[model samples]
Structure formats: structure tokens, C-alpha cells
Target: MQLEDMTLEELKRLRKDVEKAIETYEARQLSEARAKLEAQAKELGYSLETIAGVSKTGSAKRLPKYRHPDNPTLTWTGRGRKPKWFIDALESGYEKKYLEI
Candidate 1:
């Protein structure tokens, strides 16, 4: 049926369905991306479990200090919130350089 001929309620329902499909697609894409990242890390001599650094009891593993991009004067250990460096870099953006899995 033509969209113009559909009732408002029907249109809303269609929109909801489309949004749900998009959400599902996005979730699947994210899962794939994470799996790929894990695989790449493994190939680079890092285990996924170690990357996430979870203990036997499921506690977070220790993270090393990293430099902040926004404020070079500052450094972070990756334990707390997104460091200024990451936030700034993300805001500035860079080309998607994905490692092959």
C-alpha cells in the first residue's frame, strides 16, 4: 500500500517496525565489530579476556596509563571515565582504521 494512503496509526506502527529493524541491524553490527576487534587483538598477541582484563570473579583487570589527547598535560589509566584525550580525539575524529581479523 502507498504510504500516503495509510492511516496515521498505521504509519506510526510502520515507523516503529522500521526503527526496530534498524536497531537490530545496529546491534548485530556492533557485535560483529567487537568480535573482530577481539580477534585482531588475539592475533596481535593479546587475549580478549586479557584485553577486557576481567578476573576469575569477573572484576576488571588492571589498565595501563595512557596519555590524554585533548590535554597532553594530563594522563589516564583507563579506569575511570573516557579520558580527555579519547573524547577529544573522538570529537575531532579520524579515519576508521580497523585491524583485519
Candidate 2:
């Protein structure tokens, strides 16, 4: 259809429909990618659920505690922080450290 023949309202409706279609396509692509990753993990002796658990819990392996480099008083569990540490560091001048490897 010619753009000049379409009314403003009609053009708006068409744009909305296109946007919805694009969103649906993106969601489907994401789902497919996740499924592929899960399949690969399963083949490598890890289930999707197990992988998800590890990701959610940081990792299944043990990690060493990290200390704040600037200030030795603050420490981390090597899994980022439960609460934001940047603000605390700014306020308390506590240095943050993380696992080197």
C-alpha cells in the first residue's frame, strides 16, 4: 500500500503491529538460544536445572573470601555482594577485593 494513501491513525496501527511482531520474534529467538545452551550443558553431564542453580548461587565450587584492598575491614564472599558495596565503600572508604583467578 502507498504510504500517502494511509491515514495517520492507520500508520500508527501498522507501526504498533510491526513492533509487536518484532517483540514476538525476539522472545522466540531467546527461547531457542536458551534451549540450545541447555541441551549442550546436558550433553556435558550438567542438567539445565543444575546449571541454573549454579548460576543463581554463584557457583557449585568453593570460592575464597576477598577483602577490600583499600580498607582491610570489609570483606566479600567472592560472589559480589548481597547489598551494594560501592555506596558503602564510598561512605566508609573501605577497599574491595575479588578473586584474582
Q: lDDT of each model, Cα atoms only?
A: 0.54, 0.53
Q: Which residue window of length 10 is worst by lDDT in model 1?
A: 92-101
lDDT of 2 by residue, 1-101 (tens): 99889999999888866654543453345446667988999899997667766553544554324433334454455555543544554454333322111
lDDT of 1: 0.54
Misplaced by over 4 Å in model 2 are 7-9, 21-29, 54-101
What's the TM-score of every candidate structure?
0.35, 0.34
Q: Using lDDT as the measure, which candidate wins?
A: 1
> For residues 27-84, could you state the per-residue lDDT of candidate 1 as single tens digits?
3454476679889998999876677765535365443334332233454545578655
